[model samples]
Every structure is written in C-alpha cells, then in structure tokens.
Target: MSYLFIILLAAVLVYIIFFRKKVVKAAEIAGVNYDELLDVHVPFYRFLELNEKNRFEKRVREFFREVRIEGVGTEVTDVDRVLIAASAVIPIFGFPEWKYKNLTNVILYPDTFDGEFQFEGGNRNILGMVGSGYMNGQMLLSRAALVRGFSSAAGKENTAIHEFVHLLDKSDGATDGVPANLQPPAFAAPWLHLMHVEMRRISAGKSDINPYALTNEAEFFAVAAEYFFEKPRQLQQKHPELYASLSSIFGQDPADGGGR
Candidate 1:
C-alpha cells in the first residue's frame, strides 16, 4: 500500500513546475508512509519526542508541498522526497514558521554533476549546489549523494544538509560566514572570529572539520553545520565551544538529542 501511494505521489509531484514557489496546499503530502520513510532515513526525526515528531512531519509536509522537486535523468523515489524535506526542516525546526523563501525548486540528478550541471561524463565532482543569477531560486542535488547522506554508511557529511545550510547563510542578504538574520547581531563578530580560528585549525590538520571549510568563511559555516547536526554528541565532546556556539546560532541543541 505504501509503495502504491509513493508511486502515485511521485507521479503527481514529478510534473509540478516552480509555480512561483507557492505552497500548493493540494490535498496533503506526508502521512503514515512518509513517516515510515523518515524513520528509515532521518536520524534526527527518529530521535524527536512524539509531539516533536508530529511537528517535524508537519514542517516536512509544508516544505514538500511548497518546493517543486523534479528529477533530471533519474527517477525520484519517496525516499528522496522525504530525505530532502527532512534536510530542509531539520535546520529550521527551531523557527516554527520559517520557510525557504529563496528556494522554489530542487533538481535531482542521477549522480554528481559538473559546473555546467552535467551529471554524466568525467569531472562531475559537485554533489549539491544552490543556484544563483539566472539560475537563482533553485537547488540541485546528486541522488546518490542524497541517499548516501542518510544511509548507515554516512559519516559526518550530509550533502543535502550542507546545501541547505548554504541557503541559510545566504539568507541575511550576504553569503558571508555570519548569518546576520539567523544569528543575533552581537554574535556576528564573534562568529566571524570563531570561523577564522576554526579554519586555521582545519588548515593545520588539527581539527576534524573538513579542509574544504578552509576555502572561506561561508564554506566553513556550512561544513561545520554538517558536523554539528550529523554527530552532535561527538561535536560536543570534541569541540564543545563550536557546539555551544552553533547551538545558539541554529537555535538547536542537538548535542542534547532533543528539539528546541
């Protein structure tokens, strides 16, 4: 029955265009089967208290209804939809009414893509990307990378979540490491300084953070976020200062394994 529902659901959603990024409110999206999908893929949703779980589901449904997710040269399963929605919801769960006002559509490629958005052929190294310029208001994800992020084989990296954090960082009208709109004004300076310190540690190979974070403050923020959410306990133990600061920034204390 769940399989049948997913097949039907995918059929309906696959044809959905951007439609101005509106929340269609077209009948309902997530349900028992979606819950099962979340339970299987998303650890954050599984750990939520019963009430919080319902709220999480509600947010996921809203995002699923709002964003137009279409496949490019691949088939999108319910698993992909749920995982993508979960990625969007988990970061902003602290802000109940928050929505991705900037993003209207998400394109799923069969695998990693190159700069030109070509998923096949050599040099296809990009796992996920948030678009800009003529391509603004869109996001792209590698299906394989998306699934791997939620699978048992996943480590501290979650490609979908990383891209969402990038969107969050860009929310304050700037792509700088400091999310002025997300974090308190006073903390912006400190956050920038902290990013520098952490980037140096990563550069020196003295940190567990991905070296890619050293690319810039923006990348640092996104990379650290993946670490924060993926292994909160480990982050808390190994990098308590980072954990505390991130908890404040995101309004989420995942280290405690509970919702805000």
Candidate 2:
C-alpha cells in the first residue's frame, strides 16, 4: 500500500477506536438504526444525493460522539437522538469544518421549562433553548416539541434547528443576530438594513415570515434560519434578499438542491 493510504488507514483506525466506538455504544443503548431513522424522520436528508447522504451520516455520527445527550424526565430513544443530531447537522452541512464549540451537551426535557428548568403556568410551551452564562455550551430541548417540529411539513418551527441556529449566532461570543463569525464587516450594514425592513414588514403583518422573528435580530436570524431550511422555496420566493443573505452565511442554497 502507498504511504499516504497507510497513514489514512491508521487515522481511520484511531478514530474508530477513540471516537466511533463510544458513539456506536450510545446508538446500541438507544437502539438506533441510523439509516432507517434518517430515511423516515429527517426531511432535510431527502434532498441529498447518495454521496451527500453518506457525508451527512458521518456528520451525524460525529455529532453524537462529540456531544453528550442526557434525558432529564424522559427516556431518549433512537429516534429522539437522531432528531437532535439532525437538527445540529442540517444547519451546518454547508460548512464542512464547522463545529459547535460553544455547545457540549444536550439536556432533553419531557416538555418546556423555565430558565431554572421548572415548568410554570405562563412558561409552559417553550420548545428548545441554547444556554448562556453558567449554562453556556449546553442546550435544552423539549421532547414533544422536538418530535412535532420534524413530524410535520407545515411550519418552520423546528425547536432543535432554532436552538442550533442560536448556538451558531453565539459562535462569535454574542447572539445579536449579526453572526460576526459568518458576516463580513462590510456586509454588516446591509444585513442590518435588511433585518430592519423585514422586521417592519413582519410587524405590519405584510410578510408571511413568522412574526416571532420580530422579537429581535438574534431571534430574527434563528427564526429566519428555520424558514430557510424548512421552507426554502417559499423563503426564496418571498424574501429573496434575505434568502441570499442566509445563503451567504450558511454557504449553501437549499432552494438549489443543497447546492450540490
């Protein structure tokens, strides 16, 4: 064998031993059939060709390996794990080298809870959240909302995707929606202008984009990302400029079959 091939083989062997083994064990415990899970549950995977699907699968495995997932009040099944990993993978598939450095663990709850992880009267239906302050590098997800997010094809409210988008927004040390890591300095002004105009339109109920996006630029970006991935064609049709901006940041165009 060639030296390069030998070296690559060694690297793969090392990865399998040190990383892949742990993920395989986790999947076994969860009884996860990844191929079946992706085929049945993950809608975004439907758009990928075979080669891309393989890459996506690898990313999913790697995500599960790197991030620790624990159930708080529910048992995490293979489907639940797959859904969570898919949420993380779908958003960053366009950026091959990207990692959720700020994210290390995912805590799954049976349902939405308050910041202290307590369910109350008014704060009952939160879907998912990315952590900050003492809870940094963590994510909390509602199992029911998570299932519902991917179970339907009607709305752009995938809780997992929303929180992952927030993590991406937080990558540059802030989640102000500017995405300093992704946004070029020169493009910041135009991006802000676009956000303002869209927020106004949403406030006026003139746009079909989610009104929740009007909460702030940070939420606007996350909500827009959910639409970008879940309803790409509609987003591109109605808000081409915003879609283009998202395309620039994510480095892919879902409207164009995931940009090959």
Give the per-residue lDDT digits (tens) of candidate 2, residues 1-260: 89999999999999878676576547544556677789899878977889999999989988987788888979988888889999999989988988888888898998888767765457676678888789888899999888988877548678789999999888888889988888688988899999999999998889988888988999999999989988888889889999999999888789988621
Across 60-88, the per-residue lDDT of candidate 1 in tens digits comes to: 87897778888999987778888889999
Compared with the true structure, all predictions reach lDDT values of 0.86, 0.86
lDDT of 1: 0.86
Model 2, residue 245: distance off in Å is 0.9
TM-score of 1: 0.88
Model 2: which residue pairs collide? Answer: none
Candidate with best TM-score: 1
Measured over all alpha carbons after superposition, the RMSD of each candidate to the real structure, in angstroms, is 8.3, 8.4
Query: Which stretches in model 1 have alpha-carbon errors above 4 Å?
Result: 1-32, 258-260
